[model samples]
Target chain A: MTILRFDDWTDPVRPVKRDVIAKLPEDAGENPPVLFVPGPGHGATAFAEHWLPHAAGRGFAAYALTPRDGGKLREHVHDVVQTAASLPRQVVLVGHGEGALVVAHALGRYPARAAVLAAPVLDRWATMGTALRVNPLGAIPAVFGGRLRWSRRQLLSAGAPVEAYGRSSRLVTSRKPVPKPVGDPPALVIGSPDDRVVPRKSLDRTAARLGGAPLLFPGMGHDLMLDAAWTDPIEAILDWLTKELSAAS
Target chain B: MQDTPDIADRHDAICVIGAGAGGLVAIKNLREHGFAVDCYERETSVGGAWNWRHDRSPMYASTHLISSRPLTEFPDFPMPDDWPDYPHHTQVLSYLERYAEHFGLGAHIWFGTEVVSAVPVGDGRWDVTTRSTGGGAERVQRYAGLVVANGHNWDPAKPEIPGEFRGQVIHAAAYQDTAQLRNRKVLVIGGGNTGCDIAVEAAQQAATVWHSTRRGYWYAPKYLFGRPSDQVNDRLLRLRLPLPVRQWLYRRTVGLTVGDLTRFGLPAPDHKPYETHPIVNSQLPFYLAHGRITAVPDVTRFDGAAVELADGRRVEPDLVITATGYRARFEFLAPEILDTDADGRPDLHLHAFARKHPTLAVVGLLQGDAGVFPLAHWQSVAIARWLRLRTTDPVRAAAVQQKESTRPVGGWSRTKVVHTRRHWFEVDHVNYLRSVEGLLREMETSK
Candidate 1:
């Protein structure tokens, strides 16, 4: 989409769409580039740096966008939809965490060839419940007040990496609309049993609601992309998507 | 990992002919989509025409990019900023090599290999005959599909006039070095960029230099307002002005910067500046005015040691160089394989797909005044995606099939592909880009 501007104060993270980390292939004949959206508190590099080289290694032109300073959840969704719409070919939307929520919201508005949602925050309130159980001491300030001012120890205990946690908004006030099951281009749902931030069971609910099977990796952290065993889930998504795309075509 | 060469190992592998820029893009894109690909290059390496001294490279020693670096290079794999506005052939070759290595395209390519023939076996499969450039034996293999990116600059076209000249005659393609021109009077025939470049070059070394033209060309300066001329035009495209207005504006700028050629003995341009590709040269105008080079009329006939002009003038020179241009040659393919017009150029759909022989296709067959690298890339994209849709999504393929065309309308073509004389596959760069965008949009919406 067009350049979307947000008040820098709102999104203190200052999302920037920098040059991709790896060399991309030139394809006028195939599907569009992969537009990746990072999960909550994570920047474009958080998810992209982990898998962009791999995506390029596989022959796909993968790119990402870091959301700018503060805006409502709807604004973030709008930006993602517009970005996908702007591509030359039908884009493949791969989003993680809150970024996954953006991809889910983007589907009906903007048609994609396929979608991949990794540890999506489907229901924020339920996500808050998981946040409390993981670190109850830090949960009080986040719920009562408009701040998620948790220490690094609290975030680590809650299964979040310092890199992603640092960029996340200190407050969560937006109510996102639930997405219907994806059936048009189909979708690949991936998660890890050790994902304590969004919780592994939430991934099952999301997969069921989206009418797709859950691709789960056991003993992996919420930062599945950064974890050493990230390939397990990345390859799973890559494998399922290849077959699903070929079968559909 | 791409070294697996047994066709039986990959039942659905795509075979790409030529490992040049066009074929490189095709190979990489196909692999990215999960299709196994094998790229065959007759040369020891890639870069296509940009590679100097390659078996098929038409590049002269002084050959620099006609388009600027920003316009010519791929967007994702960009040339370094330190590079000149227009880089030499060596720089371009290095850039392409870096692209191949950066994308790990080495394994995908088979260096020093030639495709002897490719015949459609049946049901979207091809029986390809290839031979190693070394003393190795020939071998035949099966592939799911074939993409012909052999390029169109190999064979030189030599036109015949009424009288025959017994002097030292040569085609511009063969004039790789200028050492032979020293102390000799040279006459370069043709009005295209090659003719102009050599005429200007011969002016420096040859005793006397005369450039003959059948047409009048609008000469454009290499730069405008301190930026590459094409880059300035790229910025102008954002305004989205009407075609006539854009042409008029460009003509005015050219007139303001590079004055009338008639004063220097060159005839005024017969066609509008936009009618044909812009001949960008900074030295031609300077050399003509300074008396280093003389511009002459069309060569009506030739005599031993003498050349007669249409204007009733005659010139006797030691050498006659014909920069007449090249013809589209598919030396490896049989005549009946793909349909061609009277001009001998293939009449493939979108300048790519051959519907009758569904398993066959071609890339880099079309030309635009702008950067052809990007154009080749887009053509490769169309071919690769179409192959995927042909098998994966028939409903979408049906929709795409509806848009399948043999016309140059939606393609980046200026005149028809069958037009007479030089420039059969020329394209209006901006119009071509828009047309490609439309095609891509139509395909995306179909799914």
Candidate 2:
């Protein structure tokens, strides 16, 4: 059975367990904690303010990953995936914006019960150039500044159009496609109709590529979890997770 | 002349009317071409449709622009990266306000001053009359040339129903917000974007919602494959194919034509194919797909709490919203200079020069699958160039007008027009801009 408890990563952090779940109900024993991945300039605090209070009221053991600065993307993903793997029960991953891309990478390594991708940047190369407003070339140095290094072949394999960047340039090539999960999990994709940064068409394309995963298109701003329109869809996702976990149990 | 005030009040240039999307762009173009220009606006703020508030404003609840942010953005001003993909009304307004501020357009604009009349003077000029909304003294101004950018949507088209329904009936034009619709059953009439959005908002609040469409329509969402479908549609519209062929190709690429709304559980419309409202954003179809909204046929009669459809089905509703569309009202403009088509739109040749008068031009009257801002801006530039050439070389201006006289009026005709009834796409926007640019460039070279 899944248990909910607060564990501090930082030494100075307070050890508070305000709402701990000792054990999941027998019916929901196989269910996992809903891990929220936030967007840029946001962290767990934002999730707590916008979604967690209401989610907690609805019987969800919601948890947000604390934001880390100057960390390698793969390392962070590995840490989160490792923690989720050690859990007694399966877990569902929910991510927004750049966090969505991170979750997808992590999912490639470790599959989850299900995933809810809200405004995720699946095509990192295209997204870096267009959606995120960062210089595509500049993003390379910033994201892989330290220990992490991406070769041109790796970048080319990861869906970056090699010819557009330059055929001769070795460092600018795409990364290899992340390996697909053995048995694909059902995914729920949510996006804003008014999301100016991500092309609205991308949301549908992402859903279609996922083999007819259910989609929740809301006429809202880019921030899905914070928007009032998300209430119904989030509830639906949690309920679906609960039912699936209970059935497995 | 007995020292009359009317004779003493003669002015130098012609008046440009209505400082909305069309007017602002036109004025900027004229100023760029070094033409002495003055623009008059009825609204207190700049951003025409954008300036109109959300609550109690016709543009409230579930309204996202069909145009891509890139294409919808004004020239030289990209939309902020942090904004949502489809910008809200407030964002659009702020963008427009910024456009005006960036161009120093405020000084040229006379706000709260309604143009009462524009009588053509015999010598290539117009006698203009204006009344301030604050009840100040009426003012008269005249100019060398006039451009009408007043735009459409100020007047609401109320459908002529046979009987009075007991339910509260509201026109989509006057609809401010959805707060009044909470917990009530709503019947939203019309299949246009406004009607679809109203239905979506109503479904979120009301106990139930019944959307009435006069005909079936294919709705392309704001995006496709994570890119703006508008961009795709815009590109398709610009191909060198014939008009009919282009229409057919457009239907195929956009996915599903009329009578296809049933797949989404939306009712097929029953009305004759008239002019379709351009640019219905994609949000409404998703709402229908979720079963939050139900679709029905046209309203034939109203029976207090119940409404009878043309299909002979009846349903009761607490609130009825007629998203039936709007008419272009230029009653304030003098009848002599303002000539209109059967549908009440001003008849202009090439959407810049009026068929009735040469000195007076009309911008923003042309509405297609493309956005009006870029088109209006470009047309204004053309008009300004044409005006400059006319003053410097009258012979050349006359010859150009004679050449254009043989061409058909406007881009899309009522009969030949293929109404996608979808929002503006980037491809269409680029093509239209290019076309206008080409036209202006040609005019410049001719001079």
Candidate 3:
């Protein structure tokens, strides 16, 4: 339940005030803790709270990154790696939805104890096209930081589950080459076959690049963690962890 | 200590069972003193329980060494410094491989060989028989001595849960990974360390994880004061602090950090702390506190997947995992040769030597909180030297027999691990180690 703030990665020389939220474990020990990266615009408290408590209860020190005026996709990735490296040892890094892309990008430099990318926004255009279909006025941006500009009201109210919305405007213009995961035995990607947000092809590609199959529950959708059967995805991750860890050892 | 003159040469080979941790160390110690040793392992690999995929491996997915690396590593050969403090099961097996290779124990090891039975004749000799794993050949080789290094965990101790459990039930020994638990509601029976570990994993993967315990258990964190808990305790023992002071210190530490079990809805432990084996789980209590996992009473009965608790509540789970402990078994040896109490524990004099037969020695046979590796190492040393000196020095052998100390082992009570069924052999690490030191010293000191 403890909240910790870490320096933002976008301004590494003199990072900004604590924009990230992490639940410091009561005790940190041999087993490394988990670092969670929520999708940009959606603060850590709103999105990452769902599983951080679960991780803590299971005895892992849990963390959540909150990029308020979220930066470029790589900046988010840099922030995740920096935070993980700062920890005592390698940690399990989990990113949800668009945040999954950040985690996948981070995996190239800092291979984690295990990486979980859930419903990634791999091909930015396709993901934005899918979002545009839902909100023509709210075509979300792909990059964050000061590159792209948009009104706060327009970005925050986009239709998403539980007030957890990602700013599409902060992403549109800063168009550097988007990072695709070149993961060796890639990160454990979690995708939804029935996801309405991220395109099916993008999700499949994410899994294929990661080298492990996507854990897609039959009836679950894009917001698997917030779904009534949320336990399904969590369980899959746990089962996958058992295999991954045993293999890593 | 110099090896005694042999009536027979190295041709008088000693037969060893199962190339497990105990068996490997036993073979190495015996070979160190010039004993011709031929070890048998049913599995091709040298590491026994640490070999995850081996059929005999009872290790679950989340298994890590309860004891730390430095403390658990062998005396002469240490684990790689890069290994984590509490190395995972795979790391442990690899360490064992390195140990086997370093000591050249693999040369005399007969992989895919299983000991069928060991029978001792009237005199101090044994008829050892072994069969190749894949129906290759049966060899009945006579040996001067038999070292039963085969551990006690092979036999699954299935607690008879009264009533019908129509749902899928599995013993923890049979559990391989978490695949079976995913997308299913699981109920874990028993609250031992294994049970707690499996229950914690089940909570993460299963639809709903329910934990049932017969009674509350004392819990020990993996580390204390930035070091492994066992190492800290070993230090405390080295300081030679009084027993009461140590117990008091431990009770205070656990009470302060872990807090009361009743606070987490778990029943208070029936016995005092350190009375039995404390559950060495660092996570189970946390989950229990958050209500992520529901703790229930010992099961009264089961109807299908539905389990009725001692309290009237019933839960219909998809899978029921019995994380029950194992019973000590010596199936390969003659039942009559080793006498026992009412329960099945072999009534031995020094936890290693047989009271009736001098030819048989069960090394590393007892349980202790301080990693069994060091204890097994010392026990093997004592047994090897004792085997060498018994006939040569009768008075010293008698002295070794008479030097039985009231060792205070964690989880020694008949009611704890053994339950009402049998006596669980618990070895106090300090006392047993000291007594073995005394035995080793006596072996040297005697004329």
Compare candidates 1 and 3 on TM-score and give the better one: 1
lDDT of 3: 0.68
For every model shown, the clashing-pair count is 16, 45, 11
Quickly count the clashes in candidate 1: 16
Q: Please state the i-RMS of candidate 3.
A: 18.9
Candidate 2 residue B355 C-alpha distance from true site, Å? 1.3
- Maximum-TM-score candidate: 1
The sequence of per-residue lDDT tens digits that candidate 3 reaches over residues B1-447 is 213222232246788887889999889888765688989898998888788868878888778987666557654344544457788898889778866764568888999888878777656788766777887556676787888887777678887878887788889998878898898999999887788888888877888899998887788887677666776777766677876798799889989888887877788877765567646788888888877789999888887767899989999987888887787778788766778655676776567878788778887777765667877877787778777776677777767666543333332322334343322566556665666666677676332
The CAPRI class of candidate 2 is: incorrect
Sorted on DockQ, best first, the list reads 1, 2, 3
TM-score of each model, paired residue for residue: 0.68, 0.59, 0.60
Instruction: Give the poorly placed runs of model 1, Cα more than 4 Å off.
Output: A1-249, B1-10, B134-137, B161-166, B406-412, B416-419, B445-447
TM-score (chain B only), all candidates: 0.93, 0.87, 0.91
Task: Rank by lDDT, highest first.
Answer: 1, 3, 2
Model 3, runs deviating above 4 Å: A1-249, B1-11, B402-423, B445-447
Per-residue alpha-carbon lDDT of candidate 1 for residues B244-302, written as tens digits (9 for 90 to 100): 78789988998888888889888887777667767889889999988989889988888
